[model samples]
Target: MSGYGVVIPAFNAATTIAETLRSVVAQSVKPDAVIVVDDGSTDDMAAVINALNLKVRLLRQENTGPGSATTRGIAALSTPFIATLDADDLWLPTKIEEQLAHFRRFPQVAGVFTHWRNFHHDRPDAPEAVTVPGWSRSTMMIRREVFDAVGPIVDPPGGRGEMIDWIARAREAGLVLDMLNEALTLRRIRPGSLSYGRDAARDRGYLEVARLAMQRRARNRTEPS
Candidate 1:
């Protein structure tokens, strides 16, 4: 039997953490271990975790960005495969089971990810769901060895470009991530999420991520085969 560990990097997510935890707990394929890294949230994140009575390992630290928190959480786990979920997002019950099955079928792949569905809380009369096609951070289940080869995610200063930077780096490293062709995660569109808002700093952060990734690709190309 094979299983994966889950790492959730949360910051000031008291309102949604409970639901998020429940979603993971309800997974058809339970995680072998669940680690949540609280990045200096003023809210009662600890209390929420405690109240759940789940076997979750909690870690605390100063207000580091999500990238750093995720790194810490991954370092704390020893599972062969690792997955991530945003504090406000929900994973469908079959997410891990299906991804793991894909891995077994194509052991050469570095990871598996799925498209995501955006659930908007603002418009009650809006369509029930809107499908977004692309790789999402929360939907990923990565092989541990791939991280060693490509390196941990490069979290931009504002934490906006970490996933983009990571995917770019992985592609440059020849890591192949399979698309599951399904929406396995529900991304909540609500206030206070890091995903919310766009600003000059955020734009610059994306450019910086692209620049760094291009440098890595060029460097990898020059290295001896």
Candidate 2:
């Protein structure tokens, strides 16, 4: 099997890191290696990773935010493909197997993203599926070279906007982006989630990404002839 690596950037995630690790460890198509980047958590998150005894490469750095931690993790990977999972999220057993098959089927595809189910942390109800447009980072798997070409994931001023900016850049670079249309991951919604209480900020973040995408499109349009 061709190898793929997983990067899990964590911060103050002691409450959920174990489950995330277990899900990765249980993947039907196991990762070539798993790396957990502990982004300066002032908690027992490191102890949690140690107690799990998972076969994951661990890297610790001062709190530089998720984009920086993700960049560090990707730089440390020796595989051709890379996948990311937030500490509060999990992958289904077939997530890797399914996405890997998709990549193989579409060799031209530089990155693939899947639909996700969102659930309240303590709720048993089925998760709500969020229909995202075009390329999104909430559910993505990408070739390592894509990052190498487009550069590191940028820290978009604030919030989860950096994800959108990265995707926009990939699209601008003529990278083929596709949706697997399957619920490969579960993104948990909790009390203090940045997405939960910061409505105005989140909306602003979305607009910033939209503006960036529009600017890229306009540039592409006027470049030739």
Candidate 3:
């Protein structure tokens, strides 16, 4: 209910991770811990982290995808709440403060997500207007119970859709999830990022996630009350 930490899943994010961590450090509510799990990054992530002079734990592993990296970061934290941030995103100074306030207001919700806007990495000065409540992992502040009840971010084959599966699974498990209307995150839209370009593999992951969700729904429908 009180303590929270930050987990960042990185894959060759050395160029952008320092700024991401800076955003965390700028939060009004300081995190209990911060961990970055590098998923087989061939970059000098260690050097970048060291030079930043910020308190961050760096963990390295083979290329397992962002979901696995995120779960690893989550497991390494010893806090009641876990907030995730992508290596290429930035959180406004009040991001954590606003989320913690939402928790106090809801009292019973398992997770809180805020709206976000995307900005081109090269044109950081030209951020788009905040449009909608984005139920993204980068915008989420969740209780550890959500994972304990549901599970870690699904590692479907390929690029994206794992978070979609994660959110769906959380809902199926009857967890109380809510999102704030306030935009608190700035997503960097850059080339070479996982979500930057769509491909067949990404689509395949989507199909797999959808199938799994449908199967879960069917199972729930058949289960006796």
Candidate 4:
């Protein structure tokens, strides 16, 4: 075991998951294990993954949100360190290697992330590569201990801001985090993706995330330290 593993939470991601898995397998520092939680995917997601004959462990469950799926995936991984990736995202060949390097350099930090660029799923070839802004679920690599400390990701009612809630909680717990300036992940911009369209559900999710975050802040302020 390399003491490193990956957890991917997928939902009807058959269209792009193979390429995403390829990106992980092609990493310079290959993960020791990869676990994928199929969050009640209606598509042929499982078949697609199986056809690839890749080194992945697939678990199926009811239609839970990404946060629940992510929690399940993390629990199934035994590695001391874990990295997460979305089923539709791609990482550079050296993404894991670079993150591991950052960990070794900043031993005090709880996690390491890298910058990323957005690429249209249809035009995968034309992406400019390496853009501003990082620190997404697909870019975070952290110790298993931090995850246990933080607990499972809180899946909101609308199901879009769970990661946002989890990160805020991690920060509230005082765990130090770091992000590399170099871009190593490519976020796929797809029209049918959950985060693509602005709808009532997404808006409700955003509001709930904000409300929960604020609520946490209030509780923290009141806690007897």
Best by TM-score: 3
Residue-wise C-alpha lDDT for candidate 2, range 1-225, written one tens digit per residue:
479999988889999899889989998888899999998889998888999888888899998778888889999998998999888887888988888899989899988888777777887527455643324444678998999998987655555677878877887778898888777778788987655666775567667778878888898799986
- 1-225 in candidate 1: lDDT tens per residue? 478899999999888899889999999999999999999999998998999999999999898688788888999989999999889888888988899889999989998998788776454323346666557679989998887787776568666888888887788767898888778888888876778777777667788897887787788789899
Q: What's the lDDT for residue 212 in model 2?
A: 79
What is the Cα-based lDDT of residue 198 in candidate 3?
77
lDDT of 4 by residue, 1-225 (tens): 246999999999999999999999999887899999999999999999999999899999999788899999999988989999999999999988887887887888898888898888778544566587676789999999999999998788777888888888889889998889888898888997877768786668778989988898899899899
Model 4 worst lDDT window (10 residues): 124-133
Q: Give the 10-residue window scoring lowest on summed lDDT in candidate 2.
A: 129-138
Return the clash pairs for model 3, or none: none
C-alpha lDDT values of all predictions:
0.84, 0.81, 0.88, 0.88
Candidate 4: regions farther than 4 A off: 125-130
RMSD of each: 2.1, 2.4, 1.2, 1.5
lDDT of 1: 0.84
At residue 193, what lDDT does model 4 achieve? 84
Mind giving the per-residue lDDT tens digits that candidate 3 earns over 116-187? Answer: 888888876344566578788799999887787887787888768889999998887788999888888988
TM-score of each: 0.92, 0.89, 0.96, 0.95
